[model samples]
Target chain A: MNKVVLYMSMSFDGMISGHDDGPGRGLGVNGEALHAWLSDGGISPGSHRPGVGVNAEVFDEMMQTGAVITGRRTFELAGGWGGDHHDGVPVFVLTRQLPDQPAPGHARYVTELESAVAQAKEAAGDRNVLLHGGSAARALLDAGLVDELVIHLVPIILGRGRRLFDDQGHRARNLELVSATEGADVLHLRYRVVSR
Target chain B: MNKVVLYMSMSFDGMISGHDDGPGRGLGVNGEALHAWLSDGGISPGSHRPGVGVNAEVFDEMMQTGAVITGRRTFELAGGWGGDHHDGVPVFVLTRQLPDQPAPGHARYVTELESAVAQAKEAAGDRNVLLHGGSAARALLDAGLVDELVIHLVPIILGRGRRLFDDQGHRARNLELVSATEGADVLHLRYRVVSR
Candidate 1:
């Protein structure tokens, strides 16, 4: 089975992105701080930017995913990831309505949550699906669709912003630790969702 | 100088304790799930409980602390930790006013944040001070007083609860990764606060 793994960079307080994350300010005020690990490393072949230590390994693994799924807000913020998120992989955007132009990329808009997850899984085939965090993560976790979670725990406290897990009527979920690796500016933690 | 360290077990969403975590319900509904590792390990000498794998080592280090500082609410919630939080060490309870005939234990009430931290450090001498999370942790972080943070990153999401880090009017703070250790039910991450 192709696992749908959710990856995000979060602060010590759990903010995935900073406050005011929208069209004008995609990552919000100082939201890019969470991705400091990617900026502090030496990039080898097939790597995006420069990621030091475990950040490089984690980013490499994410780049190798077969497909990418993101929510509408994040999709718009990223301007559709130029249609393909990584290495010619299919990008599936979960949204209620499709944008007019979609920034000239290879992203396909899907209306229903189940359909998007199913199509992304099928597109992934043998490789895993790279799921974005924030609103999309909450939806997938609530629906019991995420198979694993890779949280690059940033060593800072934004104190406020968008959360990754949830704050609504969510029940207790169980997970098993797959691995924990230290990056230059983050702790790379991998957990397998056992039960929701 | 004695270092003031904050330790907390947090959910994937950054909640330290679950909803309704006061008075009667200490850990809150299903909040104990974050502490499964403590219950899954063998009881080694000096450990508070049976902690599997890294949990035992973490617990042992926590028990060796010379003093404990906690907020009034958490102090009341733990029923004062029988007055001595661990091994007869002094307990510094931060509160606006002293509790009338507080729970039987070795707790002293301090009305000011600086005073509480100072007293804890003085009492600890060369040993590290174990500062509780929640309000005290937030205050210490905001005041640029905390030296290190040890987060036992649990694998569950409670959805709603008290967060360890502040959310209102808090600036970004930087930290350096000291180590990352994986336990049976949690990932033990130690970080040194570098910037405020």
Candidate 2:
């Protein structure tokens, strides 16, 4: 079975992105600070910036993910993942209205979140289904679909912004720590979602 | 110099306490779940509850702390820390109005935060001074006085509650991760406040 994993970089204050985050700047203005650890390790294939550390190992693992599920806002803001996404894997975008023409290669738009996740899981086979975007992850978590969560606990505190677990009327869920690793500028924490 | 350390148990959502947090039920209804790690380790000398783990070591270190500084709200809500406090240390309550009568051996009310911290530092001598409560920690952070932060990261997420780093017009401060240790059910993270 394909596991659904919510993986993201979050500030010490729990914000996934800064207050001014939007289209041109997906992480917001200074939001890049949250990913400075990745920048130092040059882990993000999209940016091609220089960085070195434990994130390299984590990045390599993430590259093995077979499918990506995200919300419309993240897909639109990220400009459809550009040319940095993994090869041959489908990217499912959950949105109310489908795009007139889908991007080339493997991007698909769906109206309902459940079907999008289901389709993504089927496409992923034995590999993991990566959940990107705070809203998308929250939706899956609310539905108790996220099997794992990988949080890159950044060392800075934004003090305000888009909290990864913003109040969405979701009931409390227990998490079991699977592993913890020290990175150059962040703590890589892996947790398994305990099913109720 | 007496280092001021901000110590608190926070949920995965960054909340220090839950929505219903107040006197009699200081951490809120479900907020106690956050400290279940401490409860298991029996690190709190005041409670004497049975608990075992790395928290015991952390608790021993905390017991060496010479003083504590907290906001009026936390002090009042906790009913003045009762009898569960470090031995022979003064707990300064930062408030505008001094209680008609201070609690013997444990509590003292002060009108100014800075002065209260100074007094706590002086009273602490060579030992570390602990800053407790969300508002009090925020005040110290805003004033650029906190030397370090020890966050007991609990696995549960309380969607609604008082966040430790709630927006208060404070500038972003960088923290250097010093250590990360696994405990019974919490992650003990220590970070040094990098002052610019």
Candidate 3:
């Protein structure tokens, strides 16, 4: 069975991005004061540049099981890719405006959050589902679709920014910590979502 | 010269509390799963008990500040008081819908973020101002009024909760790391806000 997971970063105050849709204000954007710990990790957390991080094992594990899902804003802010194959993994973008099949070899866009999740499960096959950011993740969570979540807490506080989850309703999903690794500013934590 | 500072723990995915409107969700309702590491702190981060970690030197320093600010939610969640008084220190409550003032010392509500900043600065006299959360901290940051930020990154990822900053707007503030202390699952980091 595929488990849906939400993994992301937030500020000490609990904000996902800076205010006013400010560019570069994601999570600890203007306030990297706390999150500068991630600078040691090289590239920024949201940037999808490959071949980074000395500890890619966990990220690799998180990615190996399923297709990636994200919102359009997240897709564009990370400087949307010319090609969608993330280290050879297919990605499904949740957007109401994009085409059903944005790319044949690597990417596809879907409007319905349910179908996107279902397709992601299908794509995962025997592996678990890794639910990426944007509205889709919130939608899945609100619908009680996600099973597990792994959060890479980068020490930073934007004091404002696009929230990882705000107003989006999600039923309580009890969780058990599977592992914890201390990286510079990013604390990698994996959890098994146990139903209470 | 009031140096406004914000300090708090947040989820990896950017939530401040789980089920913010639900019972016991004000502290870590959905965040319990994400912040399980705080358990090692001998006191859960969301205990909401006044003086839970009040004995720390950091807490002493924080309490001695000239001014303190927080959102109404936090004030209410904290059950009004947390032991000692501010010794006539000026405490500002950031809110549009003001609630009845808590007993003992004095608290004034401000609807405008800039006014609150000005008031905090005036109240500080010569001391630094401490900007705490619910949403008032976010409002101040959104206005680019905060002078410094100190975040205690607890090593836990609450899978669900209210976020620190979501898609608001604020300018980038460069920061210089002044200290890093590993206390239980929380990493206490202090930074001087830098400018572009």
Candidate 4:
């Protein structure tokens, strides 16, 4: 069965991106440190991405997903990942205000949450649907739509910024650790969301 | 010289204890799950502590610390750990108002943060002084006094609870991973505070 997995790079203090994360400064002020491990082996010329060697393992695995879903803010800030997140896979975006003209990429915006997830799951077929952005991840997690989490737990504590988990409510969530891998100055933790 | 190390057990969502943590309820609602790994083999009759076997590794390591420091709220809630946090080690409580009668334990109340820390460190001799509770840890960390962090990363997320990292300003703190050990159901992560 296919799964809906969230891939997020978070600092030890739980910030997904530093404060002041907007259109131009996507990762916020000092949030680049969270993703520094990705560029440890320098840019991969073949993939044209900032990840190689052991550091790129997670990125490589993320690229293999059949489809991707993102929240509007992240989609706009990241410029829709130039249409295709990976391998021209369908990018399903959740947003209330849909753009009139689609940006340069392969993103399809939807208003409702379930619709976006359902379409993304269908588009993914037998492969997993890559969940992107903290907003979308939180929403999916709160709604119990996400199946797994692939968190690149960075060692730094960015005391400010957008958190992957916040303002959700007082509902306790349970996650089972599936795997833990050591990366270059990072820990790649995979967890199965058991309860929401 | 002995270092000031913070020993904290935090949930995956960064909660230290659940909501309604006061007076009698120290761990708060559903917060006991975080410490469940410590008693996997049930309570140890030898030490009269709730930790035994392989799961008690961190607990055993924690028990060896010479002295301890804790915040006023947590200190009062835990009843000052019956005055002996461990082996009759001096327990320093940071509070503005000193109690008229000390609780039947070995706790000494101090008004200032530095005094408590200094006394605890000096009392510890060559052994490390354990920084107990999130409030004291935050104050010490903000003042650049904390040297190391030993976090027992629990897998569950209690959505409503007291967070160790909340309310602190947006100053990014850097930590170098000293070691990462896999426990029964918890990940024992030790990090050296490089910058506050």
Candidate 5:
């Protein structure tokens, strides 16, 4: 009975990154326009790396979560930290390649999406699990692993970029509107996933 | 001098319409998602006719302008009432084929962008001018005709649709963020055009 939440920022366009497979081209830098609120609140911290001017509230929310899940491509792009572990949080990364060693403490890799979800649920204890990354997040949502969707809609349009939900064809997930608010350059909307 | 503003609600993927050119389908059933705010206010009469069910506030602000401009495609789609004139407001539409007859009153046909701007400025006689379509709006913005961009960032994120700004490369138009507020399922943001 654990909740899996998807929390991320997106542009008016469905793109999560400026360009696909283009380094530093993440969401066309136009995506950064959507993160102005997070940046202003110091919630996004320069890069995904923890520490440095990090927003305590946002960090605490992520840290207190039971486990973290991400896509292989997202992890790989993070270089060494792309594995299933960060800040003492047990990380479950979806991948096909077998790893030689554990990424960090409490980190592991899995080939099957369902296996990863079950593992993350076990590791979560009583805390809710957090699903990260674009593709995996969409997959998790499709598989009924997501309980809430927290989307922070940023105010700037990136004409083109990496699609966040490119393959969400014919999928319908009814959601209970939780809350909606305005952040600097973003609109924070929270929806509780009811049924898929 | 005329202060030209660009206004439109875009999709999450930055599309203005769907793959088809037919009405409703492009923006989605009478622009349901993008114009939810308008309907929520009991303003959307569910018809395309002008001066009907339009919110008094939206109509007042829009008409406060000196004149209005649109592309031939939009003007034609709007049917006869939306020619180059409306209630003493000079309307200029960008088109290769000129209208066969004079459009009622307070209207004239012109094909030049600059000429349209000049005519709009003259009509306002000290009021603002509004750009009201995709290509024509984009052209004005690209040509440094727009002075401000006031947008209602609707909440619905259509995964696919026509893009307001197509793939064509564009020059950055500096904007000074004025305000961002939450309204119904939309976020309204105002920006002053700083530099072209």
Candidate 6:
């Protein structure tokens, strides 16, 4: 089965994006610091910048992902990922309405989350389906569709922002820690979603 | 200087207590699972039962703490630590009103947070002053008084609860990860509070 994985960068306080995260800003106001580990020429597709430590490992893992599913806000905020999917993989955007003309990359829009995840999984084949954006990931986790959660735990605390898990009355879920690795400026935590 | 350390157990989603956290229930609804690591005859002052791994380590660390300061709600919810301190350490409860009579085992009440912390620090002497609750810890952190923050990161995700960093509009603080240790059911994370 193609595993549905929610992978994202988060602050030490568990904020996925800063308070002002929106269309113009990808990660919100001070959130750029959260991705400093990747700014040093790490794994960000096409740019095979020589990276070391956990950044390289995370890059290699992301490179192997088959399809990416993201929220409409994240897709728009990222400018449709610069007209191309991350490493040419198929991208599915979970949105209520689709644009008249789709962008250049292999992007698809779906009104429903389950169908978007299903289509992403089908597109991913045996490879892992990567869920991007905190809202998208939270939706998947709430639906019990996420098989794994990988967090790049940045060491900074953005005291106020959009939290990764913002569901007010969501159900409790159990996670088994699979691995914890240290990077230059981030802690990579991989957890298997045991029970939702 | 007596290091002021904010130490608490937190859920994976960063909640320090459950939705129904209050008197008679220390961790709140369904939060007992978070402290199962400490229930198996580990370090609890009088319990000298043979314990190994993280529970013992936490016990030893708690034993070394000279004084503890906590919020009024936490103190009341815990019933004044069952009428006694955890290990006979002087406990300063931050509250607006003082009780008619102080609880047993060196418990003191202070109307102000700064004075409570100061009294705890003074009582601690050269030893470490421990902040015992999420609200108390946040107050200290907001005041730039917390020198270190130690979290016992439990793996369960309580989707809805009182978060440790619930102070919205609070200043963003930086943290340096000093250590990360794995326990049976929790991950012990020690971070140096970098800035206010």
Q: Among these predicted structures, which one has the highest lDDT?
A: 4
DockQ each = 0.74, 0.64, 0.18, 0.71, 0.18, 0.77
Q: TM-score of the candidate numbered 1? A: 0.93
User: TM-score for each prediction?
Assistant: 0.93, 0.93, 0.58, 0.94, 0.74, 0.93
Q: Model 3, B79-137: lDDT tens per residue?
A: 54442236567667777765565433566666677787788888888888877774776
CA lDDT, candidate 3, residue B15: 60
Q: Each candidate: RMSD to true structure?
A: 2.4, 2.3, 7.2, 2.0, 4.9, 2.4
Q: Report how closely model 4 matches the true complex, as a DockQ value.
A: 0.71
Residues B1-196, model 4: lDDT tens digits: 9999999888998988888777887687779887777667666554534455444777877788888888888888877776778899988888778889764578888888888888988999999999978888888888788999999888886877788888557467888888877777888889999986
lDDT tens digits by residue: candidate 6, A15-69: 9888887777677777888877875655446474327776887867876889998
Ranking by DockQ: 6, 1, 4, 2, 5, 3
Give lDDT tens digits, candidate 1, residues A100-172.
7553466887778888889988988999999995888888888898899998888888867877765676766
* Interface C-alpha RMSD per candidate, 1 decimal: 1.5, 1.7, 4.7, 1.7, 4.6, 1.3
Q: How far is candidate 4 from the true structure (C-alpha RMSD, Å)?
A: 2.0
Binned by DockQ into CAPRI classes (incorrect, acceptable, medium, high), candidate 1 is medium
Native contacts recovered, in order, as a fraction for each? 0.90, 0.62, 0.20, 0.79, 0.10, 0.85
Error of 4 at B146 (Å): 1.1
lDDT of each: 0.81, 0.82, 0.59, 0.83, 0.64, 0.81
Residues forming the 10-long window of minimal summed lDDT in candidate 6 chain B: B41-50
lDDT of 4 by residue, A1-196 (tens): 8999999999998899888788898687779898888777566554534455556778878888999999988887877777877889999888878789764577888888898889999988999999989889888887889999999999898888888888567467788888888888888888998986
Error of 3 at A26 (Å): 13
Task: List pairs with backbone clashes in candidate 1.
Answer: A41-A52, A83-A106, B41-B51, B41-B52, B83-B105, B83-B106
**Top candidate, metric TM-score:** 4
Model 6 C-alpha RMSD vs. true structure (Å) is 2.4
Query: Model 1 misses residue B102 by how many Å?
Result: 5.6
